[model samples]
Target: MNKLFRCCGALALGLALAAGGALGAPTPAGFVRAQGTQFTLDGKPYRYVGANYWYGGLLATQGPAGKARLATELDFLKQHGVANLRVMVGAEGLSNGYQYRVLQPLQPTQGQFDERIMAGLDYLLAELGKRQMKAVLHFTNTWEWSGGLGQYLEWNGYTGQPLPKNPGYSWDKYRAYIAQFYTCTPCQDAVATYIRYVLARTNSLTHKKYVNDPAIMAWEIINEPRPMLPAATPAFEAWMKQTAALVKSIDPNHLLTTGSEGDIATDNDMAVYERLHADPHIDYLTIHIWPKNWGWFRDTATAKGFPAVLARTTAYVNKHAAEAQKLGKPLVVEEFGLPRDGQTFTPAATTALRDQYCGALFGMAKGNTPASRVIAGYNFWAFGGAARPVPGQVFWKPGDAYMGDPGGEEQGLNSVFDADQSTWAVIDQYSKTIR
Candidate 1:
């Protein structure tokens, strides 16, 4: 917090100090600090039940109706006790019929950005700050969504490859193609440039530089940055250290994290997650879980019941929590989601299993962390809010409503919408405890 205050401009610092109340410092009121293993704001312990509202940048920037929808959703979440959001900072380039592009692409080309989208992000940040809600700003991705590594690869003469959406190729081949992203010099330079651009941005509306903005709890290096395993760990870890240190050098105010999905690429070794995030610049740890993807839960194996999934998921939380204790940093299950019972895609789908899963996940964190403070709160995979999927709804269309799910995935496959009363009940109940 002191480091952050020292970086603020003298005029803003002086004014903030003059208006101080209980905090009694020049630090921005919303500045979050790592107090041992938990996060603190104004020196008071702060925990939260956040959601992945990754579509916020797209929705909030829409013409009038889009803005209204964003406002409604933000207001609703705040009123309902949803206190945190993990949103996108920007992507690599312009849209090109990509599966899950955010509504507005932040960058239209390498080293080129869209000012309107940047302003839209500025507006979103200012509004989130107004609600006293916090956000994690994730910049890039290992996936192709939002023109990620594929775009980086695309700019470097790698084209016409079988994307993840192609039925002809296996998922492994698609991931391998993306993993090659680590080897491209131009790709590496593009990400480094994008990081600098974002770090130095001065919000047009708030007149605040992004690094100094209090609404940001942390800067997530990328959404699930992956390495081509075995041979890739050393390189990936080096990239992480470089990227995290770059963010730290540019902006000393907020926290930094490697937005990695623990074990997703490393064959389920928790040590890999810890080692990848071993850098001191990485202030906290994060992991994501997809019950179905991980094969922990099978919709057709209902006869076997939920114990296998429940036990595995609970163990994951405990395993990571214990690792976090050793590292002595706060940890967050930043992403996890289960399909609704019956695995239906309809908006009316019920979430009995999802509710139970979420309850157990939240319970795992709350129960084990009181003394250790290593288990920071969870941010469920996604929140769809009031938006519905586009008609036919197989995948996203360019003009469809931004429902917080990423590009290319089936719409609302894991969204917790406004009408999911029971799900909301569980989320609200847990969120109240965080507050």
Candidate 2:
């Protein structure tokens, strides 16, 4: 438990009193709190090795089979020292009829929600609370896989529908269109309504209000929200601040974060990243690293390219850690992962390169370096427990099981499965070091 939670609360009252000025009371006994540059649970530093189990809530909505799978996965994660889970509260706009989107979205229409999906999330939180684990719930997404900002744009009568996987639209076209979400009044309001509904909800299973649940560690503004253009920075920053303030106004106990991919999401400008996180309401800083997506690694030369990839990752994380230190906030590498060796998207493939990369990155979190010290935790790309990828399937089909990768990516890519013993060994070694 100490290895999983990383909390030292022997002198809890003194620590809580000292830190209480910045964070007021009624936070509940075990809720995670942000103090200066660290996370605290019961007034002790709370750092962790977590997983991004984004589909947990949706899976829990699947009745008996889904609930059983969710239970097994939660137990597996807890046994392996995973104490925090980063999950989507729910997806949006599935009713848009997109060919590729989150099935059974919690909010399928403007100003309306599906009660079943909401109850699924309630069950998931109740389960997490049962295990004494924490969760970071993402309100919505910026990308198309989950019917996020683009869907909002479409709902608001914006021109050019989101075409993430469509052949007719280019990636730039999709980005430019969705970037308007920062300035879209109705779209923003629609999301605000969704946020309020989720925050004010009471769990049917636990009978605890969502705002008062200690199982939830924080609330993320959106998943990977990017400015997309330099000119859009002001609007993007404004949106972040406004949204952060809005979340704090309703729920002051839980921490708030921007699900940013560091400078990459900020038009590759660190200044923009720092400025956005400097907001008083934004409690912590988060950054994601994607070597393959960022052009640092390639499958053809996996062995040779790995060194450069690790070097670049170190530099990127160190840069963000330094900035986070200056801002006086704890930093979390909330998302980062490498594909299997040779870029194979199958559970049977070797994970040597992936394990090596993950091990080195995890080592940095507990290393003696100043930058490493600033990092509070890491949630790897995903956990795909008991979910087998369909044979010969590249992209997800309707009936396929959920993996670490979303609908937008290859099914098994970057997923750490229950059978991946080598990867779990790497995770286990580091998981024991944080506390």
Clashes of each: 4, 0
lDDT score, residue 274, model 1? 80
lDDT per prediction? 0.77, 0.86
> Against the hidden reference, what TM-scores do the models get?
0.90, 0.95
Cα RMSD for candidates in order: 6.3, 3.1
Q: Give the range where candidate 1 is weakest over 10 consecutive residues by summed lDDT.
A: 1-10
Write out the backbone clash pairs for model 1: 99-407, 99-408, 100-407, 100-408
- For candidate 1, write residues 1-435 as lDDT tens digits: 234432542344344444554465455667886655667687466778889988787765778897888888899999888878998887666656555555467877777888888887888898898899889989887776777777888888877645665667677677667767677778888889998988889988899989889989999998887776567766777777788888899988898888887776577766678886778898888878777877775655632667888887767777777777788788888999987777776778778888998888777645334323576667888989887876566777777777756767788788889889999899888888655
In TM-score terms, candidate 1 sits at 0.90
Model 2 lDDT tens row, 1-435: 233233343354356556675575454798887766778787567889999999989887788999999999999999999989999988888645555687778878888899999999888998999999999999989888888888888889997774766667786787788779888999999999999998889999989888889999999999997988777889988888898999999999889999999998866788989888999999999999999988886555778898899999999999999998899888999999988888888899999999999888888876457666578899999999999889887887787888888877888888999999999998888888875
Candidate 1 regions exceeding 4 Å error are: 1-28, 97-103, 302-305, 368-372
